[model samples]
Target: MKFDNDFFNTEVREGFEISSMMKRAWAAQMEVFQVVSDICNRNGIRYFADFGTLLGAVRHKGMIPWDDDIDISLMRDEYNELIRILPGELPYGFVVAGMYADCERLQNAAFVPQLRVIADEELWDFNDYMKYFHGFPYQRAGIDIFPLDYISKDKEFADMQKQIIKLGMEILGKWNELNREGSLDKFVSEFGQLCNVNIELREDTKNYIWKLIDKVSSLCYRDEADYVSSMALWIDNDSYKMRKKCFDDVIEMPFENFVVKAPKNYDEVLKAEFGDYMIPVKGTADHTYPFYGHMEQELIKQIRRVGFKGSVDEFCEEVASGRLRV
Candidate 1:
């Protein structure tokens, strides 16, 4: 199952276009990765590069050439500690962002926790809505930190868990529809009408649903389950699961100019997720992020639509304060 080195070698690997800007974005992510690694090492937290990151390590000895982001996963308990301590442990400009029960768009389950380290906004320069949508500043390059949770071996308990994830996913679909094309007030008004609720009550209901999803997902941790997956992505079967041993230990791998932790059994981890881990896909935009491009006027329009008529910093502040409402 070995791919020829020439097959993986390319001027462009995953259709990211290999520009200076893209290289800077990858560099920025690695900068954040280094900081995250330092914090985890100091606090004795366990984490490993996962998903495309692991693929990149196994195949390229670094970033997958077309890839621009870093992915890492921590087991449940280690994840909790990292989330709790990261805000204080990270340098002044870095922050961790995730869904809070009190935040707007609580029905949105599309994002997971991230360690967002500040980059020059001019460098990444994403649109205001992308930043506003996540309550992160435009200047931040985020390293995604997925939390792996145990899966119950019991059939009944597993069924219940799957149902909760299904319901949460359904709500996420609805949330995306309502928020896809509107100002914050318009989204609230439209969603309230759709749900037959008062506009004021819609947010509370959403937050409650999000809280339940979080609570249901956490229940598996108490059981002595032998398998784990990132339940935040709604895993319901063994296909997404791996032996807990896959993550119980680690080995460091070179990523660009620096070394980062990877699973001790990364070959098995990659094999489980991607059948032919070394094979290059032909002509795919798999590495491109949805929010990577932002024309200046489009960004301005999105900023004004969110009711902000100021700088990116001001817009981010409004979003962070919960005043922007989306």
Candidate 2:
């Protein structure tokens, strides 16, 4: 996967280094793209550049100058194929996460049915900060792969679907807290306090939430809906619904001296999302967070103080149970 000579030479706004953090992030994102593309090609799956990735490929011929992450989307069937084969196909240190993934990394995190191709790496100084204070695992850098779920063309139903999934995610976050503490009673009491409703603590709540996610994501897939959405994004008065053709008929477009899949009718797709994607927007693009290859050491000391050398899930459990203080 040869990239253009200037592929890594993107300059960002003032106070940001182009050659250090930007270069590493670009290299990591491209590497992950190669892996994902290879697996898809080998296994007969379909995927395409999406969101800012699609905008960049069409408007700038590569990554947006200030953007450092990759975004792609896969239709329902192809998403299933990638999920089934990614575990064995990805090289060591990379993981395919989301609802279909069984990786330990997501075992205790909030559960959503979307997909993310993560490239795991060694701990950084910030890992200590995140682990102790935030209860977050060692952050990985990779592409955000969204699954295009079936959605209705009707505004009311589409909005309703978004609301349903949002509530499910809130419940999943509560479920993660329950898992972290290993205490249903603790979670139930907290949930009651938050919602002002009393209910018995039961394991079925988690199972039910999981099923609700499956059902909502499957709603459009089961029928021939006229629209589709990434379904992972939070709906704050924004609609992700795009015409079905934006996903069905794909065409390859130039991206950093290579070609990647994109919608055939990208004009309509882009217009629906961004009124004029061709024109450069005012000011520089904002930098995406959590890119790999940078860490601070003072943070590492804070993590080692915890004295726990187990999976991130276990460490979170300890923190939840008051055995370890962040």
Candidate 3:
């Protein structure tokens, strides 16, 4: 179909196409989860389903038909144990895909028939299955494994986690530099050590918020669910719960499988981050924004990352627009 800038607006770009890219991503994720679960069972690595995955098991008995993601949380030790043993336990087609600890380029990129590489959904070939799709890769599709850390009293812990994430991102920038110079392969290799974090200018500017998150996350923060839900709620403005009054601990609600709890003062938090949570807030209406886009987008779509209230209606005026219960 021929298109113009105005009409083409409904269509997403090459990297964000929902239909084709998502199914492949989720199918790959389930493979990883199943493989990981089997290995964990055999090797004695205890990984209980957490967040949405568990909720899905309870609510939908699988995926939340309309949803597209999964989450499983493991306490730190369990996570570490699984990580330590994962190298040898991978199923025939599954292998590690995380950027930091795994291969520089996907190790199985050429080998595996099905592998989940976390990036834009639009890049994959979705030719045959387009008609059957409802859309994939919508925050609800991928596997998000949240770490459960022990509660720590050290208030600076949050700052520390922030330090860790920021430092890690800075390092990713360094790694990208090698790619920038067409030296990605060389730089990521053991021989490519030529780099620095530009310490002088960034020493004071980097925020330590993630550290706080890590700190609070250690307790799995009672309302951690809200942390994600509230921010997600406003975009579609039509869900009943999204319009209802929120408690700091709404994260405890059972959506599909796991018990969800809210982040600290989530309502107030959403307002702080997104002004007028009820407005037909512009930009791409998805949850993988300002946060995940930090890794990809030229601009942050700032979808419902931290928290969500209702489903897809909050952002659409054609649907009911209820006031937030903060």
Candidate 4:
């Protein structure tokens, strides 16, 4: 998966240079994406470039110069199917993390229910790894998969479902906070009183809540509904809701060195998401640009301070086990 040095250092925008490190990270993300694409294609699963990734595909024919991550969206049923099959299908050193997988090493579920395809491998040095695979830090480089769930056509019911899902997420957050503070008993009591149910505290209370939210969010089947929204975003904003037909057919488009799938009517989809989307808007990103840059520096400092010679995966394990400070 080697790339030309000039390719890694090319400037996609004037005065907004894409560094070799960031480009290498993007290459790693694309590798993970290609793996998922292969699995999906072989199994008849469908997905589309989404959000900023979609924007980038349409505008730049690749990753945005400053964007550091990739996003893809799947219809709910396909999403569930992929989650069911992906774990056993990935190559060695690659695994699914985040909400569905509940990977403890990633611990990414507390924020969103989306999944991430992560590359978990050993690295002897931070700089060397960054120059190559660019996945030295555990969750540094991956593809974010968001599920698009059917939303009811009935306005009242849809609003109610959103509210219920939002409350469930809020409770899940409180549950995490209380658990972290060693106040699970208080959370259980308060949650039981709030819901008027005899809730039993369990190690998987959070998982249970997530399941409940998922059930509520997907009450409307895609075939029966006129629209779909990001299952992870509908709880907060309705703007993500779009006509189901927007994704009825997928068309292949150029993305970096690879061809990727996108919704056929991407113009309408992008217009709905970002009015006049053809015009470039810089610097307003969902995440920090160069996603793992600062963390890489800190990890390198800690490794040098301890004179650690082990692989990056081993270092992450030590940090997870409370034997090392990041």
Give per-model CA RMSD.
Answer: 10.7, 10.4, 16.0, 6.2
Model 4, 144-226: lDDT tens digits are 88888898878888877776677767777676686788887765655455445566777566665666666677678866788
Q: Residue 11 of model 4: what lDDT?
A: 67
Quick one: best lDDT, which candidate? 4
Candidates arranged by TM-score, highest first: 4, 1, 2, 3
How many clashes does each candidate structure show, in the order listed? Answer: 0, 0, 52, 0
Descending-lDDT candidate ranking: 4, 2, 1, 3
Candidates in order, TM-scores: namely: 0.68, 0.67, 0.39, 0.80
Task: Please give, for residues 1-326, the per-residue lDDT of candidate 1 as tens digits.
Answer: 11122331224646545643355456556667777889999999988998888888878888777666778988878887887787688775455544541234321322432323334343333444233223333345667787787888886887677776655555544665655654444544444453344555354555545445555666775356877877755354458778787887789888666777889988778877777878865333344452355543565677888677787545644554466644
Question: Could you give candidate 2's per-residue lDDT for residues 6-64 as a string of tens digits?
Answer: 54343563344454335545655676788889889888888988888898889888876
Encode model 3's per-residue lDDT on 1-326: one tens digit a residue: 11121321222332333333333334445644555557766986555444345434444444433345555645455665665676676533344544222543443231211123232233333321221122222321224455544322343643343344343344344654755687544323322122222222232111222222233333434333222222112123312122112221324334322233333244443354344543322343235522233333321232254244344323221111122211
Compare candidates 3 and 4 on lDDT and give the better one.
Answer: 4
Alpha-carbon runs more than 4 Å astray in model 2: 2-17, 107-113, 122-139, 153-160, 172-211, 282-326
Give Cα-based local distance difference scores for all models. 0.62, 0.63, 0.37, 0.73
- Candidate 1 TM-score, true structure as reference: 0.68
True lDDT of residue 28, candidate 2? 53
Residue 133, candidate 2: how far off, in angstroms?
Answer: 29
Per-residue error for 94 in candidate 3, Å, reads: 1.4
Worst 10 residues of 2 by lDDT: 129-138
Cα lDDT for residue 14, candidate 3: 27
- What is the C-alpha local distance difference test score of candidate 1? 0.62
